[model samples]
Target: MVHSPLKLDTPQEWDLSDLYTDFDDPRLVEDLDSLQQTANQFRQQYQGKVKQLTPEQIVTCLQDLEQIYQKSGYLYAYPSLVFAADTRNTEAKQFLDKVMEALTGVDNQLLFFDLELKSLDSEAFSQLQASPALKNYQHHLIRIAELRPYKLSEEVEQTRNRDSLTGRQAFIQLRSVHLGEQEYPDVTTPEGKTANTEAELSALLYHPQEEVRHNAYSAVRTVIKEHNLLYGYILNAIAQDHKIENQMRGYPSTLQKQLIEDQVSEPVFTAIMEGTASRFDLFQRYYQLKSQEIGQKIRICDLYAPWTTQATPPLSYQSGVELLLAALEKFDINYARRAEEFFLKSWIDAKVRPGKRGGAFCAYSHGKHSYLLLSYTEDYNSVFTLAHEMGHALHFAWIDETQSYLNSNPPMVLAEIASTFNELLLLDSLLESAADETIRKSLLTRQLEDQLNLLFRQSTISRLELAVHQRASEGSFDHLFINEKWMELYQLLCGDSVELLADHQYDWARIGHIFFKPFYCYQYTASNIVSLACYQKYRQVGKAFIPGYLELLASGGSQDQVQALRQYVDVDLEDPATIRGALDYVEGLISQLETLI
Candidate 1:
């Protein structure tokens, strides 16, 4: 039986039995208390002596911290995901806010631990790690030491850290009001039929009819325009906050602080963005061809309009699971098996329901368990999303298994590698099994979509962000300035085919990252290039590439992006080849699509 789109206005529930049987179960409270006690004990014993502590003590403390942190993560993730998936859940809302408050208090107290550890002498630190446990964490120690230059005075640092919640965090929370509540009338298709809600409207954007795509785009814009003022305030507040912090941190350029935290250099970031921007002709050609395919003049909204006349046949949920697992099995059997486990164990909430979050994300609950949030529409995009999110889950599961809890989550640059790599593998596998020219072309177009999003859209957004920050810092921090800069970016990257209308000018306000992670959009472009190069190596070498991939994942927070890539991909980020290779890959796909047409 075919199911209807989820009723997003009402709260749809999931069976948390997969993670925990009940929030108030004895184990839940017991774990929280245990985690708190362990953290407290570790702090009491090693707070002052981290430098002088034995290597065994170092290892012991790290393991305990990971274990406790993981437990606390479970405590935090459960309600947080529930809250995000359904904003109207009052109990979940209260519980999550309470947990955040508690975590903030705990974080303030632990902020000094890392700064103090980084302050220790190399010789003394090495001697303490002489214990066998410390031997394995030498890389992590080196990483901590690398941050010494960025560490601030304890009093000042503590104050800065504590104040972040009320500033950046609060601003981001306010912005959430704009999302999860957008109410739009049903979007009408060419047949004069309506698909209710934005998600359905988004699916219709791919309809072969130009009228349908245009109407869908216009409908969504009308909804967005309604909340323009509040959204504008959120954008201005968040960007200004970043501008203030960047100045205080003494970052040399607009993006320097983000690049440093990403464990990359400014030159590397420039190489990635500049190289991609230089190849605009390749995308222009593709868009022009796509425009020809539709036999009409295409605009920016038409870029994502389905290029094929044939509707992509939808696979059932079970079949989608099999397809994802089958594709992942090409890389490693273990990858396939873990994904299969997720399907059978209810690790995924696949049901479409009201108040469930519209997007897909993998939430790793501090330790071994990982949960996936997706409002499944049972489309090909949904299957690809499952594959993508599962890739993230498996990566987290592996890192969590291999590293301390504190170290399991890698920097954002590395996080995208595994996810995008999974996508490349899926595309490669799908193309191999294509039964007809139509499916092959569709798959090729999907791949281009990936390239367009991560490489083109992200890079353009990055450029826009830099301009916005620089302009804001120069006392041009007004809505008009932001609109102008936003339009300039749209025109530059999207080419002459697309026009930015006045109402659409406030597009910057809708982006959540500008409010959350300063200058994070570029990482998508950075990681996209890196993933392409890494996947190319894997294709060239087979299982031999597995070692480097595994090592990169296992390294987690122990190494920076450049060192990690140096070990794995053997290409320096500053080299034009690193970015050029990925862009060339995009060009090759566009070439294939051209031939198909």
Candidate 2:
């Protein structure tokens, strides 16, 4: 039987029985116990003996580590998936809390093995890599040696791990809990005061009516403003935490080590950041043209407002599945088949309900099923989100079949490629089959705006991240200071195209990335640029490029971002032309929108 689209106005549910039958599932406790025991056993066997082991013993250690990691995945993801679906559930929260402590202990037990490996000198690591038995493990060892240069002493490492629960994690939980309990009234829709969470408020920013949209933004801004002192203190503390850690680790700056971890050099990161800024003209031109289309000056709140005269009707969940599945079919039969399973096997939770976490994410369990959490609103945008997460599912599915658990984690810089690629395919399919000029125009506009969002807007926030982190290091990350500093970034990012209001000053206060992962926004720009290169190849070479792209995804972290891309599509990120691909893609999108108008 075919199902209908999940209407957000009502409660819709997703089944998690595939992973666990219930909160008290017997397997939950068993899995946790198994992980703890396994970790202890592995540590006892090889913790300090890593360097002394023969090449064959090292292979055995890797095999054991893989099993341990795969088991931990099941244990960690169960409570995590439950908590995300409804953060207010007390039992779910408790389970997650207990599981985290258990996992942390397990991680500490296994920590010595990694620390010893990372501490190896270049010559020692080279000799280890020279083992033919460790041939497939070269990239993993190289990464260890590369990062070990930034490694801490055993004493410092232990203290850092133990203190995380009380330190960084406590601050993160504070923000998460506040957002969960906090509710705002949707003041725009008359006689209408619904209990709106932050997620609902943010989603309403896309409402068709201009007043409804801006009102949502206003309501959120007001709420955040009232709690500015608390939020601002939390933000600064997180930044301060990072700055101190960077200093103790002997790094030059905070983001420098992050670039290193992503296997991207500082120069490449710099070129992409500077290149996106140099083309701020395109950002201005798009918005100025949008303002003309809407017959008013664009405001910061109106940035996401749909400008098309008539948007296509709300896309249903059933139709969304069919649309995305059909798009995947053109690439490979296997890709389409896996997407079909998402609908047939009840793998997706397409719903809008209370207590659910905001935003969408795909988590692929080691050697098991891939789960996705999304608050589907049944719009053109929501359908693409489904496609996007499904892309992540498929990305891991390929890797699972071809790789071991040790090599399954792809770098964040390359992680967004599959998901965004799915969006591209779905968008092109919709545009190709669009019934009229208005529909086509809407599709084109969304593509352009999203491209700019991922490429340039993320870069702008990255700029904000750098500024705030630097200021925090100087003891100046205050509420008023953040407002003024963010305003400066606003002018740099938007120029004079969009009107900035007082409410816009506190917009940075709502950005979670600054608190969660400092200097991480640039990954979006990097991945989007790489995805564009992949998409361009598909368009140029047609079906012939499908194998290479799938092969790239299957390689996972076995190859670094640049190495994997070179093998598949010859994309050299360090090359100026490849970095400019992002700029060129935005310009192409703007040109397309111009012709449509």
Candidate 3:
């Protein structure tokens, strides 16, 4: 089916009516109220009776609990998605806050369900797990059981939930609003056009002209520097909060809580960190090759500069969609068809608008379809971003189809596999069809650069996060300390291949994950390694690998992540050789690029 190209000037926006017609939609209010009342009823019925309930009774209670959460999730997602599309929307912000507070109340009332389950004696918990009626929720029950050691008093847990709105969540929102409201000073592009707005300025960083790239870099860094103190304070407060909670929850270290939540072992994380760190020379080697190919010295600003002076033709959003679908079709027709629903049904917001959040994410809930947000610049990178988020959306679609709501959310360690794997499929399809050598070189460079960013740079960010938490553990830290540590770690990563500038110190503040989802960056490294291995297996097995891969996505969080990967992809997270093999694959890519250049 041929499709007309979506005009570059008129960006595509998502139709959010599927979630709510408007903030004032009667269903929204009804659902919000219904969620609270249902939760209240659930608490009244099961608050102190988890241990005493029979397996069938527990199944009944769990079903009610799932319905309550599914409804609450439906209500919360609407306002949050609204705010994400436009942070400056006051109504959305207020609605989101109201929903959050109400949900916190609901959550506090329902908290005893998990607490009581955790408090159960080992023999009784085993009996429940062994029941046929409880088979579906066995993994869920085991996960909660693992948290028994970290369970705080119900009162303390409630206080933390209530405080988060103003404490951690409020600070995170401040950063988002601040970034949304920023009006970057316009810089002249190499094409003699003016670059205004954050996205435009970011695009200019890849401009062929060195001066244009520097201007864009400076413009962004200037804004960040102005607000460094505020960002620094927020980071410190969040870290300190984590420290306090870590102690209260009896976590031995700051990273342990997140590691436990991800269902990843400490040794696996250590292996990834060490594996990527030991290969910094490969990172530097790639930059040196890039410098030679571009015929200019590499600088912090030039990190994203195009490999050649000749620019690749801009890809229309429609063209990008068609290209992505073609790639997915080649991989699996069913996968392509699932992705097509997103475009046809207006499930994506790809428009570049003021106050819209930067970067990209696919928002999903148990009872509703997913919605994606991204500013679709007419570039290959934007195309890859589209494919990536679609991967997430498709993964959630499968989960909704195959798993119960209670078992639907995959852990962070395995979450990026499908998305990153989609990227590789797209890359391979593009490369196979490229008729020009320059375009082919450009694609290879992109593949290599993306791996470096995900594998190397993310590990570096993880190290920086570790340092920050360590500092907070010892004492308080400010912007100055964070800035120095960021530069120090980044410079070590770059070595002598790229020149680091003073403004580069503020770059750490730009990483929203470090502030919002502490210790989350390492998952990217872990997922990339696993995804690359998955892609390699697909390349070897061809169509034979598709069923198991699709089954893996459908499995959702129904099993242990490590066990799931082993069952489907046949990859082992605990093996050091697996990490080494991934790094070896990266090294091979670098060699391929070296030959091309």
Candidate 4:
């Protein structure tokens, strides 16, 4: 039986006019000019006076600096968002490149402020931090002071900043444009139709038919494999660039710089990595159970296949929004109210089109609201993704409301908390209202699979990153080295449970984070553990849990994240028990699924 494609009664694209009318908008030119002028003026006034200023004067300086950045951020956000929505737009791409170059120059002029502040003597810094006028900016000041040891000369810093446009940034853009413009060949879908576009092919991974899943997976792999050489060179360039920067900055390893930026200690990161690796058996166990439930041996492509033969009904975008809003409202009405603005204001670009970037993200600027991009395929997974990105938007909304621009962006570890917490909430709402035992089982299976993906799969990616960086540190590497390392780590996690195809070795090229944001995947695992613990506490305490969670979101980067979690959400990242408990919860989930099966 063939069913018609679902027609969504929802806005397909975002109205970016809230940021700017278009590439030709006069405000764009005005803001760019103003941003550059403001930076120059700011530099002349405060470039060399950071240390001589009194505490109150320091406060005034910071406020001024914040204003400069806020303007620059507004300028950068518009073009980047435009490019992301359609990378094939040559005009948008040109505008974005121009904005980035301008911002780099502006940032070069302002680099002196941080250098001067970081250069302050211990006694003088202590005196400044002690002042009551610096209370709100205390954490911001501390972060700068912590990086004092890694500071390079002002001239070198500026050179690096300028070079990045054609260096790291250019390579990143190359990968994006290459992926965005490549036309994927249409593959057969489970419904006897065709899956065209990367998003459609990806959605077919969950089809009930194994043949459909294999065809979809193989088709994607074939394309990526054809371009493996380019992707390989891109990854190699990025890793080598990181290594050179790490050496220049005196970072102990390639990962240390990111860890420092994230405000996470090496020990905490090690614990999470080891904790997840130690539990690989649980990942294999879940897959083994899935195989039993499906009554067949499963391959890598079958990992996301539904257990039953009947295809799950397609979820319309409108229904997806209603479901997500209902789940969020049940958690907190204020959360629901804030999310509604994304739809009413057209802040989300959810249309499936060629040249739009694949996957989903919520991009936030300092003074404006967040914008989300995703190809909504009208599936249950897409609804969960909507909730996840909405969580990020709501998180930024709280930060924008409560914190100054200087303290608005949280570290990546803290950044992922709200998004994953939203997933757990959606899962709870789904399991509670599931119509029958089969539905409940499917939901539970999805939850378990999500955990596996977030925990085990992400850890594998992190390990692969560590390996590639270590190899790059010694010398340059090519595609073969990357493929071998990826497969080695991947097989370690999968064990004998899932069949590893030859094309699976090329899978590392598909992960944008590895090329774009170094060492970013591990945060997903850490945040998953933290979110699971938060959701457990919410379940135990009920309404009493609301204030602390909201306070955590509102805190932003105003305080140290570990302390913020302990103070607000009551989770300790430093303790081994926290990691153990999260792992135990995952194991318990597997057992629950076993009983359901």
Candidate 5:
């Protein structure tokens, strides 16, 4: 029988030294003042003089801005991540909110400079691009210029940014107080014990017993249903807010605004959607096989059931890090080393304690350090989760060292490539190293399950989102309609393989990404397909692929994702062939699994 870790087990605190001496360290003040002074002077020198500045001067301005922004980013990221780890901490939250306001005040003053620069005549802008350094930012400048058509008066734009922080951001914060901190009822287990919180409740669902899964699922669903109105209002308000903004921005579709921010095209996104949806057979078939393996007909609720294997062996902190580092070594020695550094330096916050947020994420702190937050499970999935988040951490680390501040993060769409790629490598390594056929089949099934969730399941959600937004555009948008549509998509995919339990119908309530970011789910499919395509090249091309991949990461926000991805790896997202290639790879893997099974 499996036993839970004892409560009050101390979480290893991450070393904050890499960020600063402390949140109130004198260097932070010094740097902030220096940044403000430079920005103030930068505005004076280039405010009206941008069109007339020499190419050298423009490059110099870009460089200075990059440096200052990078430092400020590091400053902000540290505290924000710390606060996220302990959302209940009043002091950290207040301090972070204040710093955010102060920093926003200074940064708001400089917003006009870029908009004004983008307004420069073509000839003058062309002259500024003569320098190699300035030329490197041409695409970056061009994107800034693309906003010209939608540009408001400088006063209006500035007002919007400030008002957003105060009005919209503040509302979201207040809403979080209501929704984020709501006390979920204790999840009663089948053994007649109540889990302390939702995190523990979620952990218990992975119990090998079917009764535990059913009870946990029912209890969680009960809480969500009890609070459905509050959650529904939050979701609808956010979606409506996005829809209105997209309209005002003249974006062609609800997601177009996000795509523009992502620096990708509509057709490419369509290809990702179409290509991923076309491969539903792979997921359906896997679920079918999994259902048979589990001795029950699979249904939507059964998607996350645990494989009967050795119970989660007690994996100490060091052992977890060593296992991840060892698995990562197969991908690249450097990646392995970087992963090790993240652990050794305490870059991760893995204590599975109460009141901390559930799930995992890598917070990029620009130039300082990336922080990972997870209620770490000692199971195989947790190992994969660590590897996944580390992929993001490593990507940002490389970008932080190489790119300027404005260029540190790629769009969220491409951002997942590295993370998912890491997952693939870890899964492949574990599969290869498994000791027996049963274990191999289990690993294979698990990997396939993840792919189904990330690829087919996520794409299905994205398509439903697109449909909902389109209906909203026509003024027929309703939450009930969205929930109904979601159920339809779920049934279409799961059909006969799994029973469509009634509680499973409200699954969309749990997917925060959908409520938080419109059309964000498409990226999961995009990242997986892109990773698959890139992985294929890496396998066939050998060491030659690494340089280009690094170059792509280094390029960061300096170039659009499509251009950077194309220039480096040359995977055309718009091409049917590329999508077909990825789908075919999945089919081949499935065929291999079928043989083994």
Candidate 6:
């Protein structure tokens, strides 16, 4: 049993002593120097000899590469987390830069290894992939094979690796620091207080009170507008960087590259996009009802407003843990135990503070336990976020328990799938036990809004992303071009249910994904379509489905994405209605909310 600390924020910090003693840790410097040495030694011995290696030699070679990869993962994880906690910390920032530059150098040295492997003749490639000793790395070999067509020359690959530190990655680093260091003017609230950071203000966007939500929206707009020029410049640089890299790599299009990387076929990707976009009517209908519930026309700012004005009691950090653990217990005792370790062991950073990153992510290093980042506002959504991020932590944790480092990564959609599953589990647990109609209504509305964001909004965002990359390939991106593209997406999704706000067009200006990972948001749409169907299956079958679902998690990238999902939950990603099942589920939630209204 774990006892919660009296103050949540006090224990919210993770014990990074596990990763390093400090930025000044001699081991960090030693490890940085050692990475290049290891890479050079390995390359010197194996660069042109991959096809000549026996089974034992192949396994040994892979193990050597795995060691380097794991060390690099840990080295990168620490400074990145440190920077995330306080992007303005000059020491952490500088060390992060140094580490990134050093790793780039190391990777540049290793570039020739992959180029050599991919250049092998058909017989050599076949024999290596068929070796019994290399079975554990089969998935890794296949992943490498997937990139054969995209692999550039050794010199070009080396140049790209060397430039990564100062090119797109630098601009993304700036965006993170900029958002963290932003100072939004305080919005006075009914409780005689001010909301400061983006996370705090984001919580206000869902406040039951309309005025507070509007004020929060206005303040965010003011801050983003204040820095629009620099933000726009950063986005343009990122866009152009991708454009250059994508063209040089021979990728026909940006989305195609992302799709291949995600292990999703073009047909299934299109199915997800069209299936979700076809339901814009459901989106409009939900908002029309939401406008009536709020007793006013729903403004762009009013989108996240609660479906009710009912007040929710404040939940402390300790209580949030108990609540999430209790919810997890219904699924399985093991699930609860895994989640409990996150709180008791202090694997999570939960406090809302100045200079912390705006959104949340779970960082998993192959040999170390996962670390979670949450700008916890202690609201109801924060409670769900606790469960959601823990789902991610444990997903990778389970993978580590059973898989080798070579195949530990799942598709990016797995990130959303596990997180959203916990969210649904928590909702089901809440709705099953709660007697009050208002609480049930609130929970249902919360589910609806989440589905809205993950399904409808993300699909639209992906459409806009494709257009941005296309236009960006032709010329430099300007404010007018991005703004117009965004407005088009908003209108397509929202229909004419409410007046469109121009500030909404500037919304992409604040999205880090556009700059950091081109076309990354579609995975949310893809995962939601898959997860909703999985949840519905669980509801229908009860405990019978646990073994397969857990196996799916343990498989990591071992199985094909579509095949794994199909085997576990009978979900057919190729079918257009795979997402329609999710839309139907959302419609059901809206129906329940209607009755309560």
Pairs with steric clashes in candidate 5:
298-497, 298-498, 299-498, 299-499
lDDT of 3 at 234: 90
User: Which 10-residue span in candidate 1 carries the lowest summed lDDT?
Assistant: 1-10
Q: Who is ahead in TM-score, 2 or 6?
A: 6
Candidate no. 4 TM-score:
0.98
Work out the TM-score per prediction.
0.90, 0.95, 0.98, 0.98, 0.90, 0.97
Error of 4 at 248 (Å): 1.1
lDDT of 6: 0.82
> All candidates' lDDT scores?
0.72, 0.80, 0.88, 0.88, 0.72, 0.82
Ordered list by TM-score, greatest first: 3, 4, 6, 2, 5, 1
Quality of model 4 by C-alpha lDDT = 0.88
Query: After superposing candidate 1, which stretches have Cα over 4 Å from the reference?
Result: 1-14, 22-42, 46-52, 121-133, 190-193, 501-503, 569-574
What's the distance in Å from true for residue 69, model 2? 1.8
lDDT of 6 by residue, 129-182 (tens): 898888888877787888988999988888887787778888888888887788
Error of 3 at 97 (Å): 0.7
Those runs of model 2 whose alpha carbons end farther than 4 Å from true positions after fitting are 1-12, 187-200, 309-311
Regions of candidate 6 where Cα sits further than 4 Å from its true position:
1-11
Summarize candidate 1's per-residue lDDT along 1-597 as a digit string, tens digits. Answer: 112222233212356674567556677567666666766766677677666666666677777666666667777887777777676677876777776766665655566577777777777766654556676676667667666666776777767766766776777876664466666667776566676565666667677777777777777777777777677666777777777776766766557777766677777777777787888777778778888887767775677777776666656666666667778887888767776777656677766654555567888875567788776665677678878888788888778677766566688888878888888888888888888888788888988987978887888878878887776677646666677877877777768655445556765666667767777888888888888888988999898898789778766765566777798667566678878888889888888777877
In model 5, which range of ten residues has the least summed lDDT? Answer: 1-10
Candidate 2 lDDT by residue in tens digits, 1-597: 123342333323556777788877899888888889889888787767777878788888888888887887777788888888877877877887888788778878878877888766677778888999998888888788777867887778877877777788778777876766656765544325342666556766666667877888888788778888888788888788877888888877878867777778888889889888889899899999999988888888888778754544766666666777777776777788877776666667767767777778898897887888888765777878888899899999888988888788888877889999999998988887888877788788888888888887789889988888778778756888888888898788788899988888787767777778877788888888889888998999999998889998888878788888888877878888987886888898898788767
